[model samples]
Target chain A: MGIHIGVDLGGTNVRAAVVLENGTVERLLQEKTEPEQGAEFTIQKIIHMVENLAEGRTIEGIGIGAPGPLDPHRGVILNPPNLPGWDEVAIVDQIKAHFSVDVQLTNDANVAALAEARYGNGRGFSSVFYITVSTGVGGGLVLDGKVFNGAQGYAGEIGNMILNPNGYHYSNLNKGSLESYASGTAIGKRAYELYGIKGGSEEVFDRLKNGDEQAQRVVDDAIEYLAMGIANLTHILNPEVFVIGGGVMNAGDLVWVPLKERIKKYLYPELVPMMNLKPSALSGDAGVIGASLLTRK
Target chain B: MGIHIGVDLGGTNVRAAVVLENGTVERLLQEKTEPEQGAEFTIQKIIHMVENLAEGRTIEGIGIGAPGPLDPHRGVILNPPNLPGWDEVAIVDQIKAHFSVDVQLTNDANVAALAEARYGNGRGFSSVFYITVSTGVGGGLVLDGKVFNGAQGYAGEIGNMILNPNGYHYSNLNKGSLESYASGTAIGKRAYELYGIKGGSEEVFDRLKNGDEQAQRVVDDAIEYLAMGIANLTHILNPEVFVIGGGVMNAGDLVWVPLKERIKKYLYPELVPMMNLKPSALSGDAGVIGASLLTRK
Candidate 1:
């Protein structure tokens, strides 16, 4: 068996792991993406990080899970919103040139979805939509146990799918999108508007739990939108499980309970009885696990 | 090669065709689906339509494409919105009892998606989302050349995917649904709100063409929403081709032109360049063609 390296390229951090066949992490390394210095600097950091992780080990290839809209076919980052100053950067070519190994690239969400479907909660399911509800809502779709890349490789960018027609203006979608209503950003925005107080998701969660009427209403509204979004997914994709991860999930049942209730209310009654709702088991590990599989057969 | 019979069960009509191996239709028949007569009667009508099309020819199996939420595994129609009074109808069993042939059933949208991917405009594409802008906006998703039925076989019901935040409330998706903005009923609704005229899609199209400014505006707004919906599909599903069908597309470029432009403006700029947007080639024939491929090994 050939050893492989997986890298999760995020706006804040670049994490690389050496994954064994049984989905174990043999070794792990972390570094900053620091994209402010430009694509060349980021590319160098990625190359050095991979080299450090390999450490003279017999590494067969490397797989990268990056924030999309990425050119997976070309291994280029096409102006991701989270990563500033990166515009169609050819990171794949840079990494391949340094290591002389094959590289596979995909959206971070899709990789996370692949990981969950193949090795974690999504196992045995023919179709799964893996959503990460963090600072932003991002997702990946797996069908028949493989990643589904839609036309032009933008298939799993569900966050960009508009949820509100008259809500706001966004580039990825029209006036409304799931991200506009369900993301942590949307929730925070709503909370800020409701109370004129700014705080992280945890603080808001506490306020809502304490029955701050305004805060509770805003949270309820947001959850309603989340349910609406999930209902939409239930109707369109009809996946067996919707694997939700992200920073907001740390709030636990405060979000999940209402979300499940709303989803049940909105989904087809027949589907509601058969749906399997689960939280992410891999958590932060999903990125590395999913990234690793990209290099697998 | 064994012959197969295809059936497209529409809200207004029931269409059936006998299909040969080379994707050719040998015999065609049409009938009205008197869904108001209840589930058993509708099932019998479907059976009669199939037998009439078969015309004593050797058919290996039968495929049905109907409006959902239907149970494809058990072959039951669970009170779909389009087909009234079709509650828990055992369509596959009903057909099988009469013909003694293998039977497979799926949502009309999903089957249409299969038809397009395999034998129509979606040729060579792995994932295709087919949206029909008719009396209501319905859709089908084809993944890897097969229908992608979700956990409860209720996948590809895009009409229920909400489009707005403060959108309307219903048993399914919110008012933000594409159906709320782009479907024929919605178009007429919007037109009525704008022009105070109560008519169907034909009147809306005629008034827009006859230089009625408000009517044109209503049509344009609908197109804008349609584009946004398509843009959402582009970003979310990322399918190669969004095959536009249904009564709304009958207006042709009147809808496609502005709709295409809006999608270009709203979609992820990176993805904007790689999409292949086309109207449906099969059109009225999609149901029959899709139904024919239902049981292919």
Candidate 2:
């Protein structure tokens, strides 16, 4: 049986892995995208990492999961915020030129949702919403076991949905979006605003863990907003379960416990009993796993 | 050829009709859903209307679209706010027993999305988010020509996604859901609070059409919030188009023109050019048409 290749192309790194049919990582390779060197160079870097991972083995197909606002149907990265100087690059054709294989591409969040649907927290559900709480919040939606690609192939971009209306500004996706409050940057900003200090997100989280008063306030505020965002998802999509992944989840119980409580507090009373709030089962490897399954069909 | 029977069960009335494959309605029948009669009796009323609409024709399947929180998988209606006493009614079973046809049930909003996808504004799009800015905002999501029933069969309920953080004292869905700021109820409440009067939601839209200062402020505030909400959707789903419906949209260009402009202002700089925002194509018959299509399969 031929193995599939999953490539996760991020601004700082290009991670490639050979995935078996059962969703296991068989072989892995990593390198830098070096996007500052221009689109062609980044494309070449992606090819190099994939080639290195393949090592002359027979390959089924390839899937690349990248940052958002890109055209998933066309496999073009349209000026993602994290990867600068790469705008409207025909990534699919460029990759095809380097390797003779079928290829699929999607925003990273959508890929993550796919991973959850097939192998992680969302496996048993027909509709799933996956959220990654890392440097910034990102999300993807899976409806009936297939990625719910919107008219523009951007259906599950949940982070930008506004969460707060009284903030510095308004984002159409969500006001006071999950990003505005749950993302690391937002947490840091809130920490600084609350404590008048720099490099405090980690410190405040640590303090909250250790029972520090001021830190608890900042962390509590973030959790409140995060829970509110989750509750928004609960009210809007009513997904079976919300899979929360990404680096911030390292805060563990600090995040999940309060987030679940607040979401329950705010969800429609009828829906509150049916809602499921859970952490992402696949964490670090979600991107690779989701990307690998990208070529399943 | 066998046709499908659809029943649009609403708080005020029940409309039943037989729909042909090409999206035509025949033998349409309408009657009030008298709540004083209780839940079991209401189900009987619906069954009677559907049988009357079916007349002598052989119907293959039956579909019912009701005020939601319906367990699409279980075919139960879980006490939606609009229709009281509809607590976990096994609507699909009741209809099936009465007509001896396959029966399906979903929220009115979800079926509306299906209707838009199959026979209305949502045609030609792989995914569509159908939202009604009416008495209480409700929504539906259709992906790849199918309604997206979440894990628990509740998805595309965007109306309750909170917009305000501190302005409204609401329940679990969102303290300041879109309904709090932009729904017909919210519009009237805000107008009443601002202008100190009372009347139909249409009256406020009429006053705005006539350029009443206070009414415009109230309406404008609502519109701005709505635009902000759309922006949030753009950020999250990046949908190709938003097919808006409901009583509020009857304001026509007076509402959509400015609303679209404001939404663009909030989109990511690169994505603003790719978005398409439009008024809903189906009107009074949306619920019925959507309900009809729900039984198509």
Candidate 3:
């Protein structure tokens, strides 16, 4: 067995880890991304982190999980809003040049999907759809342990999935998009707009946890739209299971209980009993862990 | 080197065909399903059809394309409204008892998808999403020439996909479902309700063909909902190609021209350029041809 290195490059932080075959971390390191300095600076930072984590171990392969709008097939990081000023960065090529083994790249959502399907809650299922309702509602479909990135690498871009044609306008996403209704950012904005609660999603969840009727109403509305998105996905893909993660999901029972109940209303009667959904086990570590496992393929 | 028989057991008729390796029908026969007579009677008729088509040749395998709610894995035809009183009939077991080879079964939408992906317009695409806009809107996902029947064999049940929470209801499907808005049956019903156009979808198309403004508006509303469904599918699966077929598509340019133009507005900028959608090449023959091809696996 050879050493596998995983790099998760986010806007604020870049994490690197030397992961074991069974998803165990031998060593891990983190550094400020400072992406505004440019793609080259971030690439150097990633390389330094990897070198330190490896400590001269003969590396088998390296995998990276980055923000979307990037090309997984080409291994290029396009100008995603998260990675500002980093236009057309050939991340894989740069990393591959430094490493002796192969380099692979995929979006953050896909990385989590792979992690969940292989090493976490979605482990036993043949098909696993991983949905992260964080700042935005992104999803990844993992089939037989590989990410189904679709024709243009846009397969799991479910954030822009239109739920209501005239619902809400969030950034450049479609009006009434799922992200606009269910995402953490959306929840925070919704809380402020509806009840003038400036505290955001955390505050809303806290209020709901404390048994506030107003918070329940707001959450019910969000859950309703979220259920529609999941149901649309279910009717379309019928994957074995759905593993939901991200900051929004951390609301715990406030979201999970209502979500589980809401989703049932949309599924076929026969499917109701077999609707397999679970929370992500890997949590924040999924990005790096899934990246490391990508080398196995 | 072997002979394959395909049986398309519909509510109205049962068509059996001896299909070549290249999806060509060597010989075909048809008879009234007489499902009302009972599943047992229909089974005898199917066996008779297959026996006649085989003509004492060494039979290889048999495949069936039927309406859904059937268990594809167990080869059981559940109580679908189309096949009245055929509840949990072990069609495969019964057919296998009469034949010396394996018997395959799947929903009609899946069979069409398999046919389109392997022998028709979707040929050459790695993943094909085939949508049949007939009396009802149903779809199938074919990945790498194989049908992805999903967990409970409900994959590609796009007809039930919820487009609007408060939209139209067709049978027991989700309110505001794609089928309720875009299917031929839906079009006819909507046309009749809005303009008292008793001539059904044909009249709507004919009127729209002659530049009827009212027909144009009705078609536009339906197209808008249909566009949402397609856009949702595009973002969710991002398959290589989409092959659309069925009675509604036969309306030709009336639906196709508007559908193509409308769908663009809902897709991502990158996907807009690479949207590989086409008319189903096999058309009405997809069910029979796809059923036959199923035996190959």
**Best model number under DockQ:** 3
Better of 2 and 3 by lDDT: 3
For model 2 the local lDDT of residue B162 reads 74
lDDT of 1 at A216: 71
- In model 2, the Cα lDDT at residue A257 comes to 81
Q: Which has the better TM-score: candidate 1, or candidate 3? A: 3
TM-score of each: 0.92, 0.94, 0.98
**Model 1 agreement with the true structure over A119-167: per-residue lDDT tens digits:** 8888888888888887778888887777887656787677777676667
Q: Report how far residue B52 has shifted in candidate 1, in Å.
A: 5.3
Question: How many pairs of residues collide in model 3?
Answer: 0
lDDT (tens digit, per residue) of candidate 1 on B164-266: 6565443355555667777788878777766677886678898878777877887887787777777767767887777778888988778878777877877
Give Cα distance to truth, residue B160, candidate 3, Å: 1.1
The CAPRI quality class of candidate 3 comes to medium
Highest lDDT, which number?
Answer: 3
Give lDDT tens digits, candidate 2, residues A185-265: 777788787777577577777777889788778778878877877777776667777888887788988877877788777
Per-candidate DockQ values are 0.69, 0.62, 0.79
Q: Pairing residues by index, what is the TM-score of model 2?
A: 0.94
Worst 10 residues of 1 chain B by lDDT: B165-174
